[model samples]
Target: MAHDVQHYNLDQKFDFTAATKKGLFTVLGIGAILLIIGIIMAIFGGGHAEAGAAEGHAFHWYQRLYANLWINNVYYTGIAIIGVFFFAIQYAAQAGWSAAIIRVMLSLGNWLPIAGVLMIVTFFVASHDLFHWTHASLFDKASADYDSIIDGKGAFFYWPMAKGTFPIFFVIRMVLFFGFWVFFFKKFQSLTYNEDLAGGTSSWYTIRSWSAYFLIFFAVSSSVAAWDWVMSIDTHWFSTLFGWYVFSSWFVAGLATMTLLILFLKGQGLLEMVNENHVHDLGKFIFGFTIFWTYLWFSQFLLIYYANIPEESVYFLERLSSDIYGPFIFVNLAMNFVLPFLLLMTRDSKRHGVFLKLVCLMIIAGHWVDFFLMVQPGTLGHNGGVGFMEVGMFLVYGAAFTFVVLSGLAKGKLVPKNHPMLEESYNHHI
Candidate 1:
């Protein structure tokens, strides 16, 4: 059956209404209240000192706060960059099925600039509390605190300067990655907006060229970033698959987020060109990557578990044996893998809004837990678990991220009106 092009309004723009702003602010306010309550509880709870004493260190409430910040920082940053990544992938692959919804993907990058600042600031503020390698004494050969293992890897974080000084190399990588990501996001944004105005194939070709370059840069930078940001937290434990593991988690979460947004717009009676077919494609990506993430997770875990290399096995021991985090290991697998696998296996489920919505939301929250598992075990030791602070911090960051993405969406055409593949997207079918 031929679809009528006139049935869709290509020029439609998202209206960022007062009601939407109020709703987001409402969530933000609730998150703020919860955050304050969590902080108060941490201050008065008084068990951290005992826990810290057991571990031979002093603990503060603020360390938990910083850990929460770092978790959300890495989690949301991945989602944001994944948006640009998915957008670039569509263009580079010359995919037509997503042309109508491509704008939703790019809108995610709007959060990148904000994420960059939050990540850098969080690193500076929470370095000692969160990253074990950040300790200066670890590099002092004469100090009892020195770790020869960390010292051997010091160049990864502190090259071109003395070890244990400032992590100039690590900081540079952080800034450089975000800088290039934001640069490419803006480049794509400009080209797309210009294409809408000019209505030519030129912009599409140019974007494809740029997308190839961005993907090449991302392939390298994303892995290095996984090492610099998350893997380094467990300074002694390393995995050959850590980078892929992290990227797959991010990719699935990004897919889920994008699917949710598309559903939201569809419910709002926007994106007329988008239909069940487009949604199914999104669902398939989420389902596929969820398994990919699980594969990497298991691959990383199994190798260490079977080898029983004390250094490698210690990483899993920290989580799997802990009363605090042990349950979440299964929870992470169940949510990210089992549920998504079961819920999305049927073709009808992928095409249905309600089913897709439920699974996507779960995937989004599930991946957050995955990151929490990755960071908190290393940073807070037995001190960390999901509580008011973790929940509140997640809500706060989530609300803020929603605001930025929607604000960007409202600023431009929701559909890429002049995209060369617009007609192909209109006729998209499984």
Candidate 2:
């Protein structure tokens, strides 16, 4: 069986039109309005304390909104970061099928550093509402707000010498994590771009070496990042598999985004080199990671349930006990696991463009819900819901994400001409 050896014009670049930017910014502008309104409501509107009620504190509307925005920022930023990892793994492994779409992956990765900055800003703004450890009174023995558990964990999250949970270590760790990821993201990106201008094996060797080390650094840093950013919200509850769970969610989401973009480009008469073989491989990844994510989810749940440990079980109890969140737990599972498993299980389905796109959409939404479940229950308790505020914040963040990535995509050629595997990628077949 002979497959058409498609030819690509390596000189072709994406022309992200001015109209597109205007439209995205308009959406972003609307989202900004909504976000501001949501923030005002949360700050001025009073409600029963959803978190920190033990010391007679009640959670404000701002705290819930902060949690919602934080989740969206982290979730979307994570997808971008994972794209770099996905590209790195492919480059390191010398995979040929993904070579044709490397630029798309690179564009996706350019959003990581920006996301890091946004996260820092949001943290400073909502430190009081999002992070319980930021409270000074919680660590004081003479203070009525004293928390023994948080005080004990001070060395891990706070400045040990200062004797309070002021988040010195936590903030430093955030800087380090994003700094390293951005550094490598730019390093690899520069090398790949240079390869297009100066085609040689020297750059490839350098990239391979950097990617090898990056994987190691990424593994440790990503896990610790998960602990600091999300898991630490609950403060008392801990899970060994939380890092893997977070990684799996971001990984699948990133692949889904890539797949959607590829399909879109193909429909636009661009990326003629990308064929069904590439699509099939992406589907396989989405399918495999969905299972991996489900495995970790179940493992985390079953152990906590069976052991009935007060500390571990509290996390689930908080989420499950909430009437608003209880139904979404099952919904999250169904969208992330059941839908993908059933849809992409067969070879034919993996190559079906429309079906794959639908599955990708579900996976993206499902993981958003997954991240929502992970953070909201801890921060907002039962106060959280999917409303206009949440939708507006998502639009604000999503429009920005789309704008940044598309801008990056337009800066470089759509394909890497100098890539050694270019020919193989163009001819890739199952």
Which number leads on lDDT? 1
List, residue by residue over 1-430, the lDDT tens digit for candidate 2. 1233434467778888898789999999998888788777766666676455664676677777789878998899889888888878987898888988987886787788899898999998987778777778888999988889988988887664575636678889899888988999899889988998899677778888898888889899888888988988888889999999899988889999999888977877788888898999999999999999999999999999999999889898878887889889999999999989998999999999999999998898889999998888777766787766787888888888988899888888888778877878877889
Off by over 4 Å in 1: 1-3, 50-55
Candidate 1 CA-lDDT value: 0.91
- In terms of lDDT, the poorest run of 10 residues in model 1 is 46-55
| Model 1 agreement with the true structure over 31-125: per-residue lDDT tens digits | 98899999999899854554456236888889999999999999999999999999999999999999998989999999999999999998998
lDDT of 1 at 5: 65
- Candidate 2 stretches greater than 4 Å from native: 1-6, 29-46, 50-52
TM-score of each: 0.98, 0.94
Minimal lDDT window, size 10, model 2: 1-10
- Displacement of residue 332 (Cα, Å) in model 2 is 0.5
